[model samples]
Target chain A: MAVRTPTGSPSGRALGLGAAAALLLLVGCCTVGLSMELQGTVSLEGRLFPQASAYQGQEDYDASLVLEPELYWEGEGGLSCSLKPFLRLDTSDPERSHSDLREANLLYGADSWQLLFGLDKVFWGVTEFVHLVDIVNQTDLVESPDQEEKLGQPMLALSLEQEWGTLEAYLLPLFRERTFPGSRGRLRGPLVIDSGAAEYESGAGRTHPDLALRYSHTLGNLDLGLYQFFGTSREPLFLPSAGQEEELIPFYSQISQTGLDLQLVEGQWLWKLEALQRSGQGPGRGAVACGFEYTWVRPWQLDLDLGFIAEYVRDQRRLADDSPYDNDLMLGMRLGLNDAQGSELLLGMVQDLAQPSCFMVLEAGQRLGESLHLSLSGYLFVRTAEQDPLRFYQQDSYLLFKGSYYF
Target chain B: MKRSLMLLLLLALMPVSPLQALAETPEEQGHAIAVEADRRSSGFGDCTADTVMILRNREGQENRRQLRSRVLEQEDDGDKSLTLFDSPGDVRGTILLTFSHKRGDDDQWLFLPALKRVKRISAANKSGAFMGSEFAFEDLGSRELEKYGHRYLGSESLDGRECFVLEQIPLDSKNSGYSRIISWLDTTTYRLIREEYFDQKQRLLKTLFCREYQQYLGFLWKAHRLEMVNHQNGKETDLLFANYRFQVGLTDRDFRKNRLKNLRTGGGR
Candidate 1:
């Protein structure tokens, strides 16, 4: 479970810090009419484990403080810049703490067309259980085991808005390797992920440029999207180095992917589907996730809505599948409270229908005060088999609490 | 007998029902009244306004939000409007675009700043609360005459002003949360004065009262304050409107979905 830091040298670490400060300074100089808006969050998060780990001296409780500051400068004539940097300090383990540049983008243009440059983030797909087609940014796994956080992606994006639909083209010049949990961190796989020891299939190595094209439009009650990407696959094939000393090496392959995302709205039902076909690393295969959400508004006149969700995800590989969801069924319930505090609760469970394994998740978030927000999330694995990826964390079930304050 | 004649003479001096002048059925009279109201409110071209919404819970705890709204009046079709949130820092810069249709379902899109994307929301979920307020999205839509079926109820004096009460049933009730709505319009100006909403279960749900009428451009009338009280949940939303600017010259391009992202605060028309 040891994670090797690519920037291990002292000077390398300082260079990263210096770059973040320089981005803020550049943003400050481009402001117009004192439009530099500073916003951030200071949060303390704690995780509690139900069972102690086998490793000796491993604490059952861990705490950390995270500071995420964001700055934006919106100048005149369609020129704007933004910088958001995150810093986390772990009280128990320094290696577990990390810093990431979430965004540092400059945008130009006004109405029909626009251009964006620098590091940015873009999300795709419509499923709640898994993001099968969202591969633009590298996963910031060190922040959380859920892999919802993403690192900044260096790219240039041009978008055109039209009556038929919106078309966007992206040029990604750099590749960012995914981060992993350090040795001191909990809820990690048995084998460590060494990001430094990574290989690329392309001869050009990390300099291989990635290209993406996306078109999204809403036709009547359906929201449809189509995407094509030619780039290195974000998911790596983990392998052990061929040496006496066993070390995990990640091999990334250049691949082409075509994806479609669609959502249909009818009365109280919302049908969503995300499908993708890809090739390169393994045999050509297709994956699809389809689901529906039924919402009841103001049920029993309580100023709240209850939504039921059911989804099925499948990969063509079936039993020989390394994919998390080969033949899985996901069921969920969402509670939206129509309150001024913007309260919401979601409970979901993904069960592998072909195996005796299930993963359950509970997430609840709400606004605390004018500028503060609170969130509670829990992950539980039930009856996981040895072949299941979640089996490694059978005893790693924990609850995380976060309280953030915005400035 | 002499006192009764004197009372009758006094009642004759009061305002008479305009519908009495024309011989028509109850339904026809209701349709005519609605058509006149729609006609009187038309031809303003475009308008901009600022609004403050106060939401109060059962315990009387209050939370407020501010918004700016721009509307483009359509001659033969439903109008288009854009609402931008200005207060409650968390929701600031959020935009809601609505395109209403006369015959079919309305379309709505929400621009969420955190997601940095425009989401096409379900127009069928009209019963859902709007921005955590008691007012539903259906209540914020343009009042197109073709969208409802009307029946004239008896007239009554409200707040010392003679009013015409009518029962309006949604033509397409599948997506609507209400079974019927009772609206009171000022007989003199065709301005909506009060409304009662009945839920799909035929239960009394909410009541809305409009007051403090202001004349814009010396011809069009608008309410300065609108209060909606939900009886079932004991929640209320009070909207105070101000700075009504008519003939601001907005166009269809200004309300496009893509324009929502770069929309300057308080800038359009």
Candidate 2:
């Protein structure tokens, strides 16, 4: 990850920046999918975005560079995409190659879905209720700096989507450790559909074709939802050769989970409740969540959301004696800084009732320019009461700023 | 001990006072959800106010103020009008343009002051910034629900109340920004609490949070604060409501461009 410090080799850095920009443009072009216009022409506009920021706190005051040159051409065929590659030079790590291809995806639209493939970024979303539904995918698999650039492991991937009732079902094929790594996605694409509706899954994995569906509705002013996740995974419960030991959970991917959500709103007052069956990523327990919020009441864009989750994760026979990890609670808020619509700050609190641990997060961000966004988002992970020794004294802090552009 | 007993009673009554759920088939639910959304997803309800733009520089500090706005509604008669930025009363006008997945180019508009000339602002740069903000013509338009179709997803309990879930899929890609959006409507009242926006690739791009509810005109429910968080990036957007006076007294004449310059002259009132 090179921080793009324009020192003795300015031309060399420029060339690197230009090439990265070109790739970003290419990814953008591909994002538009195929052309739809019968008689179409095109026009283009782009820029070389460069930014610099300094990070403080637990670390030295080292400056980091941001170089994002983008190319954006929205064609007359009703197709358009923006590609923005980046070059970050962390002066702290001077000679390192911190440059990465970012948002290097083509945004293409088919009938029911849009596709973002390449070294891109994919975010599922946090619950509107507790803002803690951070499961399903990795929030860390960024298309930003200090992140890898494959394709589908997600450096490369293809997605299919369809809508039914208050639900949206999608299929994503990520070529990662579960599947063959490099070059696998280029040769094959994911083709999946929701299974017989007999089970809540789409039938795990592309091998047998899997599907994922999410439904969202509203009660009064609250949002409600039901979702199903299914897939076929071949990764054995334990890969001895890989030095993994322990019986792998059974029927993990086949029946990821199915759940419901409810959302309500009254004037500056909002609330949400979510009940879900454990998906493959968890202990396969059924969790019920209920939360409420208040807004516009006090100052600082005040908002509060609280949640309670009940689950039966262990000992099926004693489903009644469930633990608090089976239960979760989260609180979150947002505060505005400027009059600009997209300028604001955020704060959050989360708890695993069973584990008796929590995290409080305070993050703020601002739009400096078209592509330059400055945000210092971090959190304090705390252990309220824990038997695990490692939980005694632990904290991880991150200071990140991003400069992005669409080609 | 008496207070504790009373608190316990309140908690016992909580789940007992079940919220009334709205019963509607998928099609019926779709219609209800799309109705108001057909207007626009804008956070502003109704208000009487003035706006002035204070331009700033790279330092991000507002050093100047020039642009102005004034509103007037609820006429003596039934019809209402609005006068924007009234300086030269007779020489004023206002224009509104919607840009999105339309047939041709971006919608246009124009307002003439003298004689209250109201003209269409013809095809201009839809990509240009709006009010000095990063938002462009495409970002400011109303997301017409007519452009898409909705499917009712049933109900789930949000907070303590059940909610009707509807999935809105764009029938025409030309009409919106996201590929599909899932809307959560309160079961008792059809108010949206949360909305998930997906990109063309079916990726969850952002989540829209609506809070600070307010009751207006008895039947209508609204959110005074709205926030949209970009899931892909750390950046977020917020719309804060202030001095919202809906259905007060606004006349079409008051909206004339000629009244724009006369905003300081109380043309709005």
Listed in order, each prediction's TM-score against the native is 0.87, 0.40
**Could you tell me how far off, in angstroms, the CA of residue B189 lies in candidate 1 after the best superposition?**
3.0
Candidate with best lDDT: 1
Q: List model 2 lDDT by residue over B98-181, tens digit each.
A: 222223333332343221222233232232234333223334343444446787776778778676777888664532345777
CA RMSD, predictions in order: 6.2, 22.6
DockQ of 2: 0.03
lDDT of 1 at B227: 98
Candidate 1 residues B152-250, lDDT tens each?
A: 897999989999999999877766779999999998898999999999889999999998998988789999999999999899999999999988667
Model 2 lDDT, residue A228, Cα? 67
- Across the candidates, what are chain A's individual TM-scores? 0.91, 0.51
How large is the i-RMS for each model, in angstroms?
A: 2.9, 18.9
Query: What is each candidate's DockQ, to 2 decimals?
Result: 0.33, 0.03
The residue-by-residue lDDT of candidate 2 on A1-407, one tens digit each, is 11223323432343355446556576555465633111111112111112221111122223455554544445442234444444544443333223433343444444333444443433222133221222233221122221212222122233333332233445544312221101111111121111111111234322243456665432322334566655542221221121213112112144365656554544334445556555453354555555554533112212211222222222111121112233455666765432332356777766665666665656565544332344565545565455422142233223444433311
Clashes of each: 0, 121
Candidate 2 regions with alpha-carbon error over 4 angstroms:
A1-72, A82-137, A141-169, A177-209, A215-224, A232-255, A279-284, A297-326, A339-343, A351-356, A366-374, A382-407, B1-269
Question: Candidate 1: where is the Cα deviation over 4 Å?
Answer: A1-34, A54-59, A93-96, A241-247, A300-302, A316-323, B1-19, B42-49, B68-76, B85-95, B115-118, B201-203, B242-269
Compared with the true structure, all predictions reach lDDT values of 0.78, 0.39
